[model samples]
Target: PVHDDDDDDDDALITDAITGKRYRALRHEEAESLSDHLLSLWMRAGPGRGAELPVDSYKESVLEAVRASQVVVMVVITGCGKTTRIPRFLLEGQVRRVRRAECNILVTQPRRISAVSVAHRVAQEMGPALRHCVGYQVRLESRPPERSGGALLFLTVGVLLRKLQSNPGLQGISHVIVDEVHERDVNTDLLLALLLSSIKNNPDLRVLLMSATGDTQRLSQYFGGCPVVHVPGFMHPVQARFLEEVLTEMGRPTPPRRDREEEKEVAPDLDLVADVIDHIHSNREPGKDAFRADRRGRAGRCQPGHSYHLFPRKQLDRMAVFPVPEILRTPLESVIIQAKIHCPHSKAVDFLAQVLDSPDSQVVRVAVKSLMDIGVLDAAENLTPLGERVACMSCDPRLGKALVLSALFSCVLPVLSVAACLTRDPFYNSMQNRALVSKAKAALSGSSCSDHLVFSRVVQSWKELQGRESKQEFLDQYTLSGASLRFIHGLMQQFGENLCEAGLLDASAECLRLSSGLNQHSQQEQLVKAVLIAGLYPHLIQVKRGTVTKGGRYRPENLSYRTESGPVLLHRSSANRGNPDLSSRWLTFFSAVKSNGQVFIRDSSVVHPLALLLLTDCDLSERGNARPNHSVLLPGHSLIRWEFSPHVWELLWDLRTSLQAMIHRSLRRCDRRSTSGGCKDSELVALLVELLNNTDPEPGSDQEEFSTENIRSDRL
Candidate 1:
């Protein structure tokens, strides 16, 4: 609940004489009265803006639609004031009718950049005095409204979903405006489902969905055919030219038609684009020439401009009108966990079925199986203690679990850095200087055989630099983007705060105590790799050694690897791609992408066999007719196998059991309340740390010279 400092006996109230109901609506009336006065002053002081937008003309209609219906779908075009003005209209419309304390309005955007930029624009339009009423919130950053109610907030869809997890009723919020509904991303789709459920129990809540290019009829029907208002855009006429016209204008003859076999030999898209640019530059005036090619219709009419069509009209017509809903295309693990958190009694599949476009049943089942396999969900399909902690975070379930383990292992800093890096690419891969960037990354990796570690080292090195100029030099040297590094830094701080909120870290020390033993064995790079193995398990890859020449020379690129999917090579951008030898035969990766008919695994790191045995999900069985005592098999992967002596296997099994038990107990404690004292040291953690330290053999040591025959493969 928001704290109301003005709640006093002297505060004003409104009385409904007919119904005898005492309404606390006078505060909103006074606030609006003052707001109007300030807005008038602001207008007189400066040039008026936003009054000429197409949406401004329909403000009264929009307000009337909201007043008459439970839902309103505004089909406004781009460059209209719907995104900025509608929320204000709704808030002002509730001036004397609803209590000021209950007039909270939330507007959601599809992306963080859009949310923040729109919020800033709205604030500027509201003027300096009234700007406090408008603000925005996104992941890791926010400038929320200063007052409790009678204020508008712009936020991303994901942030709103997190709010729903804690406040299912959406207590004080009176209106929710979901912008860009046409995009139909996973978060927006889930939010719509949850909002529908919320509206059933809360009659005071109103929803306004605004989209420029969405299917208005379908959206109106989805909201039970409440009301639809269309606002025309303020479009300027654009001069459009097709490709044939462009070639005619350039006085260039069309090339002869090619057979199917020769089509692949056609000039590349970039080369054609370059040629077009050169032609335009040669023909256009010195300073007034501007040529724009846009895929979206709205972009061409933002102002009076010329639009060049690069492709044929038939090709444009054949393209899909709208994108597929993300819920159907992407994995549903996060969606399932969020649904389970919000609706505990309902099954994940049943809850997801209510979404606008629910995913396939098989996809849902696969996600559930994955959650259960990772110990996030149990047999009954309920969130476990670990799952509850993972739910509090805004990252993937696997990455979230890795964060929790990092806290337990007292290595929060390094793990947080790696997790933040995984969210997006931080390094700048310049097309012209690709070789230079790759060489710099390899140098930073320094035999670590870890692309993830390279990111952490970059951040650490940047922090160590004393001055701004030095930091800039360091970034330039490594071809890193300053903005991206700052984003990662902000994410690290935000994730640390999340850890504190989840009770994984002590809030009092602000993560300082979480690193109590920085100089200890837990701080070793190998332990960080262990945590990565725990999170990115099942993404394991088995390294296939390349043949060595008589002179002991081998090409690192010849080293092929196998995943659950067939053979894949190391991505060229990986730090480990250039290393001649790796510390272990098994490696864990962040993800794999297929390009040009070849699959490449990226952001990889070598993991000790012991880390795989203890951290990953695998089954151990006795070898029936082999000299090896026990054989390890990953549950779903049949191509990979590991063998060890019986004595070694028994020790590993016992250690794994103990580690699991300790982690469960620790997570339960975190769930109960914030652990201000931080994670207590345990003998099991110390033992595991020591074991991990010993697993990584020193360079040139005898332990690093194991023969290739020890690794058995069915394919071989």
Candidate 2:
């Protein structure tokens, strides 16, 4: 944010909270954050930055390697410009040099914005030779006169999957760049598996996987030895160090399971975040390092009575550093600073305020200056704007998972509560939050019903107020930290701006809704969670709902005995603990045991016994049974076995097939395609209602009341 005084409007440059670097503010009309500046360099980089290849060095080597083989998957590092340079290599003639080049170069990104951004950058570099040469295609957005000629297309991984699903041949695509493969996104993984199946026949397609160094190795092997290529980075070689045992350390940037998909197990990046943290910590002299002391008083609440930004009421003139606002910030992403305000407060707080206010932390202070050197406790003991964002995002520790989910379903709100579930988590050794995690989990189960994407749009809508002044005023009504309130506000603004820059103006509208308060927050995440299940189908852990808890807390009670059915909460992050706000629900047993024979007091929707039998559990093809028995046969990998009677088996199979087809269709239709102003979402509603209502195996015994015995049968 700009630091200015009415006394000297021209002195707008902000003082650094560390390393006394002074930057004179420029009165530019546009607003750009540090990330924007850095990323701008990437987007606008020219062949000027590229070193003249040693005639046959890196770029040529990559081309030669991929061209010789029918299928090539190569690993490259960040900053090496794989995303930027790979296309150049092909366009250089040797690859795409002459002859009627009919093949279209295709690239896929995790987020739609990344796809457009990369494509725009590449097209800019191609210049006049390719006015409309490079094009990008997203779910609802496309830019290309026609899909003819040799063109490079950038699209989201999910979008790519959808395209391939409809037309396996992919109608024109020669080279593919799956940038950031180390991320292991569900779409990317699935694309890999699916693409692998096509590799044997698609003689024209060549795949190149670009990943970060120090981490891409494993992903390389997973693909069975795609010739791995490494590019040395331009980052000033900072020291690299490792810490085998530090009581605790930062976890992965986003929860890998946010895609709502599951694998046999999680792949830890001890060599990434931890290693980087360790490298930083170990390099500094014990007594000379800096420390950060930032905390959030509480999160924002919706109230018509107060301003959400907490401004004009109890002015910052009375507070210090606003107790560091809670926002989710990663090292990457664009952030714009408007005005930086300093608060006045307690002695320690004041000291931190002063230190953070300093141009840099290289100097020392007597009372509080000494503490400024290390980040743990800022001289003023307050969080800098940057620190506050980091803290809020890190509040859940499992922010990675939450962020990952944001990318997929775009539901950061429920995950916001997931932060609560993360606080005071039961150690991985202990299952304290398991119950709630189970509940948070139910939000995403069942493929039979729909409303899957609604929750996503809901959270994205709720995120709108993050930076808006109205919201901060609302927070002031409570004793909430202004910084925390503003942090999220800023975070939302950042995401919104990114969506715009990514050219995700259309598809991102659903995600950008996180910044507009378009969708009212729904208590039910099932609508969104179900999509996660669809994406991560078959990788579930079912819980029975009728069992009672003994209350030791660490142990999980009886889980759904679904012959098949899980958001693999990040392996060991605080998500393992229940974020009270995020993970509040639990799975109950199936016995239908009444809390007092009341039977219908507090209840959760349970799946149909027959539905589970048809879709998840059944093997023996029995012939006479009319009802789906409580003991359903289960198939491994969640595929149901059909051991029931012909009547039961046929009925179950038909019901399941119908539900599956409808769900898959619903998944393909974007919320934007519907015109019913929310009413349009009824397709999923219709499917869910039908699935829920048709749970009875015996038409005569159609009971709406749910029995725990049929735990997996009830629909969302």
Candidate 3:
């Protein structure tokens, strides 16, 4: 008999014997089983008090397939009970065949919303008595199963990957069901590869792949000829009307024909949709018209509904049968990092090649080069200590680096806010009143000349507000989304917890509070900006000064900036979009996008030259005999050069060396989970912060002595 006490304490740190790394252990309580009467009630009620789902009919087949094979594929249709019922089937089967405390089933969803909603629906169906056994986990939030076994856990793919980082074998899990494999997301694809490897070693483990629309045969072949189970959908008949049919029904003549060029543009015709809606509204009886809108291919299967297809049937048929997997379409840096962490011995390229759809070799090489350039991987493509810490985080590798550096610099609070904002912007821009939203953002930004800082300020101000009415008023005034702010807050807390798990921060609540305090120091803002530079290095933009007017005012339109990719305008939504009189010539931007044949930078910040000198990746060797100019060039960015006096350059070099050493030392301490040797270099961080504070020139100050110069590569 397995007791609940077999699970470790919530606060307990379990050390891995192989890597000698420590991580927080999960605590599970003994789950109370549902009463016989409650179970009878659930059976009588059925799913949502309806007839049995199509998936319910195939429950025995699914269970039998799982028992027969280590890998099973279920190609169920949408609206079937595959997402919720299949996991319950596996869990109950395991409970009856084995010890209830040893039956652990993990079902992976592609999105948090689905994972959470399905978990709630399943819990509701299971009755309140056994509700604790059904739970879900997503980034920054989770209601994990109460018991260690007889548990049906629903979690996002990314959450499961994070869990696998610590427990690669998934020691206690009996069945792993991956839902929505048709999504073909990077995480899902990667999860499939990892599970394929895991199943070979753990004969006791069963892997089930569920999808509504995917290449079933290909997935089965990838899983070594796995048994496939087909479950019909339970959706009512749907009436789908195409654009021409809708227009004919409405007795509206077609508009003028478009040119071939115009016909190639595949954007949705919103006007036609509105016309259809208006016709439906006018023709239908009062209160009889019901409409539902869903995106992608799931719209028609969302129940007994009428789906209006805006595009021609031929265009729909021309669309690819399956989406190009994210592994092939998206950047592979994060995937490569995770692959390295999962299989330390296997090469990243080799491991990724085993995926269902391997990325291009050139793309993989490029990702490896980026990781090496960022110091996350060595020349031999092995995970550096920094890489290990980065792998522990559930964020972008660059943002993870920023979080670790912020902790070392004692500026975790602001950096976390900035990272969260970058992950998901909290500011709301009303399409009706764009100017008002922009004005509100500019007012909040003040003279900081930073869109990133604007987010931090908004979050801080929202938190400081006293009452619900006050908070709502504050949000309304700033045009901020309260839900997005709450999400950012949750992400900040999650990041803090990740830092603790990485051993870079103390796990104590008091230490966490202090570390995440806003008023850490007088120069907290400068430190935060410097850390941003450290994280977003190579994303630097060289600012070109605009011509001054006769009144000594700078022309905003004349102001331009250039990144390595080429010239880019400030995004209209940025706080510094029209501000030309920036304090720093160098700007660090969060992201850039091309629109209308023009590139625009967003979420930019002005940083001191000293901060860039100390933080960014600079190659002294690139200077070589060019030292007479007392200038250094960033690797792969020869278009920009930083010129300082000989003495200043030497001073900056010494500071950079010391900072690097401190970071390495702190990482080592963190890896060892050392109590005596803390994860911060107090004196060094203080000196760096003070230098940044003092060196940051005020707006309109003539500080061109240490300024950066933009030179054409040909000139260099």
Candidate 4:
């Protein structure tokens, strides 16, 4: 049987003690029933079409290519049957090959849609025993093969990475194929780096990397001169006479930014890409005016050369990408409607719609919409799969938070922390009523960091509301914002499901098991923090000593700076209003803060300062003294900066590693328990202790590291 961890090559299938019928893996009917809820989601689009053979007479080329070489690079351009044909080819290959080389085929995508859709299509095409030959593995669910011999596995790059980490470099499957390399996601890039570095050591491993015509050269070079087999698509090649040649020249005086923006449509080898695209354009179906390129590639008008073989826009989704400076392109009407509902008549609301949706709004607007569409908008009216995934993470302001949250799945309370992190932005505006926020912050400082003061104050007012049972009443009496509460509720639901999927159905089992019958006071507390920490660990930033503000008190940047002074709350008037209690002191949480006209959270994670300082970069020195002292300035982002220690650096490294390991251990133990159902409370406690121990450092000295600390506190 294919265990949850297929990486466990030696693991024997579970068997019944009495019957010895070798726990005859789940029956098709039972499996279907169990996954009925999940399948209902896909099936809801109604029954879709299955894979089919090409209408044109057969070309053994597709199947033959994969069969001949261990690793095959099939460059079948858009619509020429790459997606469908490739998986079918592998199934055929498995049937023909007899040796152990008859292992499963792993096909990975840059997004979830392709992964999920492709698997369903493949299974429908393959017919019966798909449970044994065709399967899928994505973020929330999996339909893996029972015996694992010939199944074709479709997964996302992130999932594959986790599988690799889980199995320490892909233990099972003999063939490894990577699909869609041009998308250029962080995860895809990282996976390539890992494979490239290790393929030599893994001779049994056959690597197949595929992509569009434009960027396949790099893949070839990366694979140690692997022979490339190119299959031209129906797309006709067109030459872009020149970028300006295709772009309509403006008669009126145009702004330079606009002029500059126009050129971005044809970037880098602009002339070349546009040329080929134009050729494909002329040869496209007479009436299919879809899948066109944009000024800079937004969900806007398609460029001319999309004729021959561009992915039809109407048929599928736009290849939406957000690499560096993310864009939040949204329809004006939708953003305006959302803003009006969020905070009617408020300037921020008006600005949220305009500045973010202005004609010139590219990075921020597109980023916001992309974030929102994918569930990055914690306060969205409705949630989508991508959005749900973002909401599934701990609070940070980036789109890539799921990775960190995924790590937490193995830890106790990962669900709780993920809920809290995703639900509330951890720094409330303290300056709105600087005095009131000051009161809340002061009420929170030290004193167990449990919000004894803030909770008591809020509860006192809340209790006065007599009918606090109502969500609105409870929110109003406690001075809680509706937006914040909305996020929390949604986050709670999403995290709950995540725990269930990870096999830790009883949230109460992890301490946060506060769901009534599974109730206990302060139950959700540690779990919430633990999951948040788990998701936010590697980004940890401990506060540096001696960094104090001019007022001679603690700066919220570091826990070390927090003292008897009690200045731990966020300022009210400042913009980036995050939660007060969960907000880091010496820790600077990081995420992809989309640059809308106003900056807002995207994908994010929260953790200690030391964690990020240690893992992502090294505190190198000219002669042993620290060189790049700030942790955030290490790699990927030169603009990100955070000041902290280099001494506990190694200690922070060990701590983050330990914390992650604990989460993994907890997951394995829990998964095993489903079959074993027994674990020591002491063992659970031990994992929890590893996460919380030594979280605090000496109150930092009076120094200031941040140029400006934005706040949103109690009053506003």
lDDT of 3 at 499: 81
Query: Could you give the candidate ranking by lDDT, starting with the highest?
Result: 3, 1, 4, 2
Candidate 4, lDDT over the whole model = 0.43
| lDDT against true structure, model 3 | 0.73
Q: Give the TM-score of each candidate.
A: 0.84, 0.37, 0.85, 0.45
Q: lDDT of each model, Cα atoms only? A: 0.72, 0.39, 0.73, 0.43
Error of 2 at 71 (Å): 1.7
Q: Which residue window of length 10 is worst by lDDT in model 4? A: 707-716
Tell me the TM-score of model 3: 0.85
- The true-versus-predicted C-alpha distance at residue 372 of model 4, in Å, is 32
CA displacement after TM-score superposition, residue 694 of candidate 3 (Å): 3.2
Q: Higher-TM-score candidate among 1 and 4?
A: 1
Alpha-carbon error at 129 in model 3, in Å? 3.8
lDDT of 1 by residue, 1-716 (tens): 22334655321132211111222334556656655654454446452346566777787889888878878888888777778778877766664353544667889999999899988987887677767777888897778876545577889998888777656656557888999899999988888888888788778888999888867788788778878888887766656676667777878775555554444334445655667778767875543335444433543445665566765444456557887888888879988998998898888889888888878877898999889887889989999887888776778888888887777766777777788888877788745667988988888889789998888788777767898999999988888988998888888788877777777765524443333552133357887888888877777887766645569988545666788778788888888885768877778987787766678887899887667667665565545445655566655676555555666656667778877766767787844243323443456666677676654432332222222233223211
- What candidate 4 gets wrong by more than 4 Å, as runs, is 1-59, 97-101, 128-132, 169-171, 196-202, 236-716
Instruction: Indicate the worst ten consecutive residues by lDDT in candidate 2.
Output: 331-340
Total clashing pairs for each candidate:
0, 96, 0, 91
Instruction: Sort by TM-score, best first.
Output: 3, 1, 4, 2
